[model samples]
Target: LIYIYDLPADYNARLLQYKHHALACTWRGFDAGNHTYLKDSVYAVETFFHEALAVSSHRTFDPEEADFFFAPTYLTCYMWPVHGWADGPWYHAPIPNPRPMHAANFIDEVGRWVNATMPYWSRRGGRDHIFLWPHDEGACYMPSWIYNNAIFLTHWGRLDADHVSGSGWPPDNYSQPVVYPRFQPLDWRRMYKGHLCYTPGKDALIPAFKASNSYHRSPLVGVPPVKKDVLLYFRGDIGMYREWWYSRGIRQSLYRLAMEDKWREKYN
Candidate 1:
């Protein structure tokens, strides 16, 4: 694995500080109890990959000798404030709108700089270059040109035609899915867009790890499971203000069902 050092000085030097601000802005009054899944997911993969690279004897810094080029871009960390808190309460009156376009622009600038300064990008049209874009919002707003011929690793791997807009960048087999720790069960209706549960060969579905307790055994490990008294249990955000049409429909239906006394009795 070969890592590219193409970002500006500020991004590299103050990375931890930027990440802290981004997380704080994204989750207002965020506490140690309420875990931030997006933040944990990004850092988990980054830490693991870096550790693997460190121990790997095959790793190379030289582009010519490297088998695959890795762009060490903290895209999720940088774009979190823009995507997660732009229209939220954190970015109210007098604050400049955190446009999603800014994320794309940042990526474009990095790509341009890498192409101009490095010879590898042009050598193979970036076919062998790999980029990690864990955040769903960032992945959604990523410019097509950057990942046209490159491999993109992301958490949001829903490859529905509805997601494809003017970007024309539908995440095909090339786009690998890095599955984060899902607290909820898989919803078939929700996974219809990409057939995420069924299509294991198309994209990689990485297993989830406990961020808080890494050394300890998983909750599901080596435990005699309890009886299933309840037929069904569902809990999550419903009818979000800016959610998609299909998502809103599903959430609304679930919310309605949960509210109905008859439905609850039947399930019980």
Candidate 2:
């Protein structure tokens, strides 16, 4: 059974109060309503996950009955910015987004709070705790003291993870997801590579969050009744138009190979 720690709103809800997150979505054509206010933001998955389990039959109120403790911290939204580049509308808005603390510092804050305010983390030293890390590179930057022992629910899993990308567009007013200096060579980053971003069998890798409304089939958009024949399916970073040897070049290989019509009949 899963038990969600009753962390204070400052950890989760307060982060959502940052209007820039909603702005990141609404400006991208993702209209929001109801509890789906954060729906279309790429990092908004934890909101959906936490909301579902909170009301679902799987959540246990008693900590003793819980197999895994879910720390419902919204790290992704905390890290995501209005834009990665300076041209973002919010950059010059009259009322701009309030700066959030650095992600590393936030992680430390959450870790310290749970350790002191509750007994669960101390019991097993956080081995049974589950952290929600919906960042682009997952919990790559999480401190070793916390992540080394706990479980991470993340969106990315890379064995050779090198977070060369900036979490937000390189520092404007908002500070988060620390970026490597513009001139930091690949070797320097590799030297400072973090601990166990995702250790396959040990950690859980979740999908990019999608809102439930997207799954609802409407009568107005009824599908034609017919037998479907399409077979092979794949989703994720298919490196199109030079994504810089992305997916470790696996997606690149597939992108090229999948173009051959010769395998259509045989593979299907």
Candidate 3:
């Protein structure tokens, strides 16, 4: 399951092209350089595969891991070069589409993949770390975000099913409600204008999109890309700003959270 920030008009057709490109590259052999690239590809394939890949089963080797394991990293976006676009530092290809693959369908795919390949995630002592945070604030680590939103929740719940029975592992299928929040018409248009940096001129946009988290300390901070831009403001940079400006309520909550020292690891 792939989590996308934006869906273009021709998203389905474009994805088929990406799949074709990826498949063609499969025959290329891996090299020493690929290993170096993998180290920065965010965990060199999920850590769960450390054991699975070591066993050398031809069929079950997990191509997803292998593709990620040897995928290249560039200071610039290198994901869909054939599409004639360069994102910031992150690299991700669009999933082949039946178009608009909803969250429910994606979650089911995640459950099947995890259960079939890493069933051990549900057994013994390897529970807590079964999931990896996929969003990495847009960089070589960006997969951390996509992976988290796409597969982590499903896998984590599946792994912890014994403790949190029916804790929403495979999301309710057949009942996906289109619940994307309605954006103000003007606001939505601005978002589609492509990647822009966090600066005072765009300060008004902050309050409109701000989300609070212990991971953030400053009231105003730069957030990563939710969509791709043909041109990037910063070379390989995803700059987000946290604002203590208008949302005094959120700021106050953060202050109390800070006073209690509830999120030291994240803030520090």
Candidate 4:
């Protein structure tokens, strides 16, 4: 059974503390519709977990009788107010200036407070504690002291050598069953094979937001099925072809290959 810490009122209060920032102005032309408007992956999961624990039979209020401790705080949601600005399309927009130092500061202060006020944090140096850091930036920005010791639930599970080398995170520090934000369009039939957002074995994809506009339902009136004509379809940008390890070299090559006379005739 999990022993969820009854965090000081202030910790959970931080969500309401930054309510204005969370609902601040977004780019003018951006229209993801009401459904996808404020639906961020980190925020979605954080909310679900909080609600789940609130009603779960497995949760224990007593710290001494618990097997593992849960630290419930919406750290990412708090950071979103400062980092959530957008001037143009998200793909082209630069990230907001001055990375969220508040997140790190919040974690540090919480760690200190917990250590001073409770015996659990110091019992085994937080090895038995769990922290949910779903946002990529939040996971990356966590202070070394807090990140190194606790079990972190994150979405940056693309556990490659580069991530390990850059973050200095021990390979074993993260657990499997990566939790990501809900996908838009709740229906699987509407998703293309190549465009599917998740990795099969490594991820546990959550449900789409109730306000998601990605899902569409056709009228139930009887209608003939439309005939299929096109054999292959591709859309979206080819991305900048650059000489970097993460550049779109493969995409560039595919575009080049598709431009060849024989391939064009075969597909087009």
By lDDT, who's the top model here?
Answer: 2
Sort order, lDDT high to low: 2, 4, 1, 3
Ranking by TM-score: 2, 1, 4, 3
lDDT of 1 by residue, 103-122 (tens): 44456666777788888888
The per-model lDDT (C-alpha) reads 0.47, 0.61, 0.25, 0.49
Model 3 C-alpha lDDT per residue in residues 88-153, reported as the tens digit of each score: 111121332111122223323333444455533244222222232221111111122223322231
Q: Which ten residues in a row have the lowest lDDT in candidate 2?
A: 91-100
* Candidate 3 segments whose C-alpha is farther than 4 A from its true place: 1-104, 116-129, 136-268
Model 1 alpha-carbon drift over 4 Å, by segment: 3-6, 19-58, 81-98, 162-215, 218-268
Worst 10 residues of 1 by lDDT: 165-174
Better of 1 and 3 by TM-score: 1
- The residue ranges of model 4 lying beyond 4 angstroms of the native Cα positions read 21-42, 82-97, 158-268
Q: Which prediction has the highest TM-score against the true structure?
A: 2
Estimate the Cα RMSD of every predicted model relative to the unseen true structure.
11.8, 7.8, 18.3, 13.8
Candidate 3 lDDT (Cα, 0 to 1): 0.25
For candidate 2, the clash count comes to 1
lDDT of 2 by residue, 123-229 (tens): 99899998887765566666677878899888768665444432332332222322334432222222224676787776898877555465456344685544556
Worst 10 residues of 4 by lDDT: 187-196
**TM-score for each model:** 0.54, 0.66, 0.22, 0.51
